[model samples]
Target: MRIAKVEAFWLRCPIPEAKQHRSDYGLLTAFDMTLVVITTESGLQGFGEAKAAVGSSGVCASIVSCVENELAPILIGQDARNINELWERMYNGVRDHYAIKRGRVFPILGNRGLTVSAMSGVDMALWDILGKSLNVPVVQLLGGAIRDRMEAYASGGWAGADAIGEQLLGYTAKGFKAIKMRVGVMDETVDYSIERVKAAREALGPDIKIMADAHGTFSVPEAKRFCRGVEDCNLYWMEEPISPDNKKGTAEVRAMTTIPIAAGESEFTRFNIRELIELSAVDVIQPDSAIMGGITESWRVAALAAAYQLELAPHCWGSALSFMAGVNIAFASPSAVVIEFSSGGNPMMYDLVEEQIQAVDGQILAPTDPGLGMTVNWDFVKEYKQ
Candidate 1:
């Protein structure tokens, strides 16, 4: 079958007030999602999502327009089965001389990041289509899964130290052996960050693992001091201690702290990952499925990380769509330590996905269905569609 048409929908769904979390990118407020639907000649279609900002329904519209008006024509008559080749062609088609030079500007694609995000949506849909066509799950296409489940780190403690401590204990009580908390937002005080990590350690006890994310909000000195201060906490990893693109900053942080440095969510493509890995910039690699070229590219990132003996723990920050996509990658990954749950405390996640992804005690069960396993609630999709 050949790709016939591609359509994108910008959906803005109103989230319940009670369900809003501090980190709910848009859950409490109306949030926008760019959903891409690729139709084939035989009438089979697959769905995917792009990383749209909250209330950026128009951005989603523009992305869909780019795919339908610009990229779809390039693929309409092409064989739908050559997923990888098609992905390369799509990449090269837009990675014009300008994108090659400025890195932000592309000749065919006006914005590089948006173009990558849009392309990721399309690539994910193509994989979904291919998996559905083969009557197999995406993991099967990626050589089957190695593990039955992934360990989950309770990803958020946003309510403050006490609240976060309670959350960590909740995960521990539930049997999770590890949890990750957002740092660097704590007044930029190493003392404050250290106290937060210490509080989590105190609440969870010694055996449980704790990780912290600086969220690219730390200055080099603060990160260095914070990493050193928390060295005794035995943090599983210190994530994005500095900006993702600041290789020097990350390297300095990595050198200063015995704690493992984790990064890569903001990064795109295998090229960035290769450089990060080669430089040993971070101890763990965090490639997000939605932001890092979807599954096609993240799998490559995982592979490259494996080659370098680095850990792969995806940075999950979007809706359930992106979360499930991350699950597929983790399922097939050998070096992945834990899949991050946006402990952002948002209900859009629980609302958008029919299958609730709760960690039983501490580990997440692998999705058993084909493609991304979990099905999207289109009714919810419709409600949220802008």
Candidate 2:
């Protein structure tokens, strides 16, 4: 089948009960998802979503434009069944040819990174098409699943100490064995943050696993102090204590704390992750399926982390589409420990998809449908077209 048409949709779903903490400065905004659809001449269609970062729809738009204009022509008559070959052809188009024009001239500006994200959306859609044609789920295409279900953790956005404690109990009661707490609201004192962690540990008791995220809000000294205070809280891990750019700072924090450090949500490709892993910067790897070069590069990142014996816990705070994409990676991955689920928005997540993935007794059921398996809500598509 030859190429027919490609379309891009940017959707902004509402967040009910938006709340903010002193640590986070940005608005606790609603769910915003960027959807990409590819149609083949034989009538088969594939769907993909890119996790739009804060105000990057325009970048995603450029990504789709490049796919439609530059890449689609090259693959018009190629067999879609050769998913790996197609992925290599598309990726090498940018890395081998485009990189010399972009990366060499203005390496600091990062145009190739943008191209990688765009290519990621297109590459994932191709895999979806391949899976559908073969009548198998994406997991099976990715060498079958390692587990039937993934254990999940509950996280609250802009939640206060009391609210977080109560939320932790709710998840605990629901049988969640682990939970993640959001921190680093640019606070100097960090006393309130420590108290929140202490309270969560107390409420959940000793057996439960707790992880803390600074969200790139803390400096080296600041993160050290904050992590030190909760040293005995029995945290499962600490995430993004410093900004992704400050490699030296991240390494310093990694060395200072005994708590396992995790990052890579902001990281894009295998090269970026290789630097982090080489420096011994983080104990865990968290790559967002929508953001970190989609499935192709993400699988490479998982393999890279496994070679280092590092854990993979992807940063997931997008629509059910992005979450399910992460779920597929988690299912096939052996190093992945837990998947993150947000308590930040209501109908925000539920309204964005046709059906929620089954989360029974704290574990998410593996999707059995061919490809990504979730239906795209076209009405929501029309509603949030930007």
Tens digits of per-residue lDDT for model 1, 1-386: 89988887776665456535443122245555677778899987777777754212224777777777777877888787787766666676756444445654333443347677777778888888888888888888888888988888777665466666887776677676877777785544768878888888888889988888777878898898898788788888888888776887788778877899888888878878877877778779988776677788889998988888888888766667677778788888888868877654344466766877777767888766766655667797776666
lDDT of 2 by residue, 1-386 (tens): 55576665666655554333233645544556567677888889877766546221223466556667766775677776666565555666645455444553222223336556655666677777877878888888889889888888876624577777777787778777888877886434578778888888887889988988888878888889888999999789888898898977898998988999999988877778998988889999988766777788788898988899999887777666567677888889899868887655534356656876556777887769888876676787788766
Per-model tally of clashing residue pairs: 11, 1
Q: Model 1 misses residue 328 by how many Å?
A: 1.5
What local lDDT score does residue 279 receive in model 1, on the 0 to 100 scale? 76
Report the number of the highest-lDDT candidate: 1
**Poorest stretch of ten by lDDT in candidate 1:** 19-28
Which regions in candidate 1 have their CA more than 4 angstroms from the true location? 23-31, 53-61, 94-111, 186-188
